[model samples]
Target: MSKRWIGLVVVLWVTACSPIDPKLKQYLVEGERLYVLHCSNCHQRDGQGLRRVYPPLAGSDYLKENLPRVICSMKYGLQGEIIVNGIMYNQAMPGVPSLTELELAEIATYLYNSWGTQTGLIDARRIGPLLDSCARPRPRR
Candidate 1:
């Protein structure tokens, strides 16, 4: 094969491998909106929260490794010890159960995706189960 053909093949291969999902993009946009309405005040518009009161979401380890826990907290709020960035905080994370399941999912997706490396969507599929589990905890976390 000619060098020109090889270059064309490489370009096509790259394009095919990294197809951006339109739905995923759409969810991200909506998630931003959800974050604003529900989380911005405490976490701030830039995901930076008030000192000792709210928790920063930017570069948050809890947001990444403990994704499910984040979802649980969002669904039912936190009442005990919590860490944000490198700081430890103990505050009442007010519940937002009034938010629809979709809204919760969107916010979850936004926070999860915003931190360091992007993550898979925390959509209705994962959220439905998590919410169900957290809202009425048979065994507390």
Candidate 2:
């Protein structure tokens, strides 16, 4: 191909791909800040949790399978034993009840997108119902 044609093809390829949404970018920035403040203590800034005590969020099978529970845990806290990857973790992660729905979405977005995961934006709209569902008490059978 001619140089001009090659250059044109490259430019078209670049322009054809959409840029990251501005809202997602903003959420990532804010989410990172929130993660640093609330989660970095145990999960670490790298998303690699402390060995044995905290499960690694970087490549967590638990996280991959438990989106609703993970979202609930952010607001209501998580307790008891859980398996992440293949290891068992039993620490009680304290809830940050003060976090708004949007904040939760931001944090979720950051976590899901970072550390080799790419689940995309966890919108605030999606968070509200999940929180409500978790808030309701389950009836005994």
Q: Clash totals for all models, in order?
A: 0, 0
The residue ranges of model 2 lying beyond 4 angstroms of the native Cα positions read: 1-17, 135-141
lDDT of 2 by residue, 1-141 (tens): 899999999999997786878899899999999999999999988999998998888999998999889989988788889999889999998889899999999999999999888888889899988887785324349
Measured with C-alpha atoms, the lDDT of residue 49 in candidate 2 is 96
Global local distance difference test of model 2:
0.90
Q: What do the candidate models score in CA lDDT, each in turn? A: 0.77, 0.90
Model 1, 1-141: lDDT tens digits are 999999999999998888777766777899899888878988899887788788788877777677667877776777878776678888788767677777777777778778565876767677777766654544546
Collision pairs in model 2: none
Q: What is the C-alpha RMSD of each candidate to the true structure, in Å?
A: 5.1, 4.4
Per-model TM-score, in order, reads 0.76, 0.85
